[model samples]
Target: MPSSAPVAAYPTSTRPVSIPGRKPRTQGLRNMELAFLVFAYVIVLAALLQVQLGVMGEFDFQLITVFGFLVALTVAMHLVLRFRAPQADPFLLPIATAINGLGISMIYRLDLVNPDITDGSVPNATAQMVFTGLGIGVGIAVLIALRNHRILQRYTYIFGAVSLVLLVLPLVPGLGVSEANARVWISVGPFNFQPGEIAKITLAIFFAGYLVTARESLSVVSRKFLGLRLPRMRDLGPILIVWAFCMGVLVFQRDLGTSLLYFGLFLVMIFVATGRLSWVLIGLALFVAGGTVAALNMEYVRKRIEGWINPFDPDFYEASGGSYQLVQGLFGMSNGGLVGTGLGQGRPDITPLAESDFIISALGEELGLAGLFAILAMYFILVSRALRIGHLGGDDFGRLLATGLGFVIGLQVFIVVGGVTRVIPLTGLTTPFLAAGGSSLVANWIIIALLLRLSDTIPNQATTRLEVTT
Candidate 1:
């Protein structure tokens, strides 16, 4: 004999329930990231081995041992992301690591030929290794501390103020240091830092945050001008102010590259924010007008323009601040042809600034066009993923921030690579992670961390929606 409670009958039909703003756990994202990291490390180790065999005619076990520590740090970063940001983009870290490793190998090759590089200062390769480690550490810290990407919006004006101070720091007496005709670095004790590198990051945050609230006003349409809807005269203050700021950077700091990068970044973000083609057109006209004026009035600007026009001119080639470096880089790349001169076999050392401004050329000389294309492809993938993250984001601020950061890297690459290849006049901007500068390394790595954070937080519609069975 059994006493039974009435059985609760389940519904036969099932329906999907909508849950807005609900986040679901992502699967296998960390595993994919780990796989890519391992592949990146393998590439780094192979490149280092080839560099050693080519430069030293033998392997150096001591250097490899030291590099193991850097690898360990990267592994630690991967583990941190596994725990903190499991949904982050997988390609960012591995791509950066591979490029950084190649840079280290190239720098090491340069170090082998230049014995005087270590006189009273750290060797370029060693310093770069240290910077890479520090950059990775900074990235890890960013991921650990910054739990949400939206938190940055709170400090938009503060970031703006900080960027302005950074831009102006190079003008301060005793603390300011001028190098390579640009007054954009500050000297503190024995270290010289380029604040503008970090300023770009801050400025991006400011632009994104400012635009989030101001896009509607800035997007107001007036009369049609040249078949495009233009903004009202009253609403033009922001663009004008930004244009003026860029001109100031050009005139005072003599840094045309930084000015262009900052302006282009703002222009891209504003266009994305407002969905206005007229703003881009207006921004372009303003920049062109400004560049034309600077070229007419500034001797250095004129020289750079003239150099870009005719680098092979005998007089310009032999001039003090002319196209010698440009021509040498071209010649070296020509010597490299389709497939590079093979690591240490080429005389890339003959080119000045090979380790810094012209690292792309140095890479072209050794790795050939194929290798350069491959590296560029990696950059493309990295930037495209960032833009994708922006596209997938549910919030306006996160979308704008991701887009701004992506443009920062893309524009900087175009500026550097274009200048090197004579597509544009050269300006003093580092090649992101590949160039030998601690400030740039740290700033770019922090950018990677921000992108990772944003990726993790982007709402996945597929993952969030669930079915209920009755």
Candidate 2:
């Protein structure tokens, strides 16, 4: 009996296993990365200032302060990202920092040319810098907190509604400040906000979400016409409505850049999601027709066309009432030639809004063709990265979102660069990260963050599947 009892005892069960959450020790490394970023920024800023002081004989301490503050803000953003979304793509925050730093440097350079903000005072580069910091802060906060694009997709409609409200708000009596060209900038205290920038992001989300939901139906071939496959006639209505609405916005708001951006984005998304070349052809035909009609009916559009054809022809310039801005831009770019006059040594002051629409010209004057191509390369990298993210994304919405965003970057760069070079009619669109606008900078940072989040999710999804299989 004693021997049987000794043999029958079972091993005691082990205590339940506990897995620890991955602590963000990488936060220290992130801080080091941010420190390197700030260091690079300081080097660039110092180089710029040295050049300016050598040529112009003076430097502004206010501008230095602004740079310092912006650097501080960027460091803060990195810390926030480490604390919140430690496992997120590390490249994103540094890329954002570089972009923002570049923008600030450009703005500071412009401030040198137009230092008088209010009757002999140094222009408030500090203010722009502050906004840049704020934009970076908001971008990091959104990316860290949102954590997933699904949540954004879930509320796409609501975001669209809010964006639409913001877009139309300028139409209200007192809120919108209408310039001579018909852009409605709302001035709040000292800050001017362009709702169109915000609208672009919201509309892209809505378009991506809507397209993902409707992809299969839209892809269905109802018939063919002239060797071109066509979608069901019912399916065409939604796209048509979107196109018409965009046209209305163009006609009413005089926002040619926004209108073109929206239409192009929609067409590209439709083509990509459906993988149909026929849709692209149909969209192209519709675009041609609409453009022709716009040119004929809209005085402003007609002017743009005439300006594009021959900016220097006196008769065309007079009839189209082409302003001095584009002319100055051409002059600045031409003065630079192949190598440029060198930073701080060129006459970029002649170009109106040299910090915004014509910043490329300024960059050309200062940094030469090499610098211009470098900026273009950055845009190309950004677009390629977004497309890669789209391709690797696990879900239709994420793919569409990434693609739509890539399309946006492509279109904006084309429009702005073409406008500056006089290859197309001047559309007053900022050159994304390099332009001096609060709304544009902020909106673009958010775009970068979303793309990074999407990039992060792709790997995580793949890893999860592999783990499940194992």
Candidate 3:
């Protein structure tokens, strides 16, 4: 069914012409992604097999079947991206998959130690697998439904309102469910969801859209302080409002992690939009003052600081609401040493909330410092790619959004990992893709979809410019 025709293009005028035989570079990029995904999945499968062998002393087909289903879902997502977002960043999905896979395997390993687990009570690993599929499905839905990230800019305030509502929903008396000293959850039938997780994304969107329009005013220099150009006092309204809101969350909601995350996200995005270092300094000062006051006044907050400062103290270690969990997590990581005890060899489950809040320590106890480094390296690559997307983006909104997204992930990793390593006071922030919270997983996958969409537009925007010139 071949027609005899010229494969080459000839330009008769000053306009550039497309060749009939030419292929878009996006196809090549997608091919590279496919190859990378293959390698990533192979590593995941190998890890799962090692866990099975180490824990059960025999290969179990159940986890393998779950892994197969996960692979199918991810492959389906990859295919969708091929047609929908071929020019998207290739590394995001693979890195997310590898981290999520490791989390699932570790959770499964921990489940093996639970002899009391019954068929009626679904294991954490199985629940995590189901949630992973749901997250991917939501991601695909986002890609299909949200064709352009710019459309979100149209409803900036609407998103801001939604974020506020979501943030306060956990504080509603009848609906709120407090756990682990923080009121950050709400029960929906059989599940407890953290609305703040989704709120983080919405807040990022709001910050990006608002900053794109307000950056000019925000950039107005009032005076110099400490050799830094500061914004006008009037411009300080925005940061002050956000800072107060964050402090309110800390005081009322009793959730330090979410409060810090929201403030940090806004500060980073605003600073990026205005190219202002003074904003960073001022924001840091405001948060430090707020935290200090809270630490001095609040009992729970004071105890957390004390726990971080001296977890081994006999008085604090043996108290009812003491440093027992933190100390145990440290001991577990100490057991890991240079290299891990291997996947299933270490007693990671001995640490409280090993598969959730203290996942990094659990992973460290089994995978060692080297394995942790490898994981952190993947996180570094992922965050760097997001920042690169922001830098290369053609539009202001895209740039700010991408930057905010990168900071959200980067700051979260820093907080969680720093807390685990005793470098900072611990807070309840899930490790993006590697934690066992369905709300966090769904929100993060949606973030990936947004990043993919933004990256896809970079090439399309370039082609549009070229076409306009031609």
How does each model score on lDDT?
A: 0.89, 0.75, 0.89
> Which scores better on lDDT, 2 or 3?
3
* C-alpha RMSD of each candidate structure in angstroms: 4.0, 5.4, 4.7
Q: Any idea what lDDT model 1 has?
A: 0.89
Give per-model TM-scores.
Answer: 0.94, 0.86, 0.94
Q: lDDT tens digits, residues 75-134, model 1?
A: 898899878888888889889888888898898889888868756778888899888888
> Where's the lowest-lDDT run of ten residues in candidate 3?
461-470
Q: Candidate 1: minimum summed lDDT over ten consecutive residues — where?
A: 20-29
Poorly placed runs, candidate 1 (over 4 Å) = 1-27, 118-120, 461-468
User: Which residue pairs collide, candidate 1?
Assistant: 340-368
lDDT of 2 by residue, 134-242 (tens): 6777777786688778888888788778877977877776777776476547877766788888888888889888888888999999888888788888888867887
**lDDT at position 18, candidate 3:** 53
Tell me how far the alpha carbon of residue 6 in candidate 3 is from the true structure, in angstroms, after superposition. Answer: 26
Candidate 3, position 213, lDDT: 94
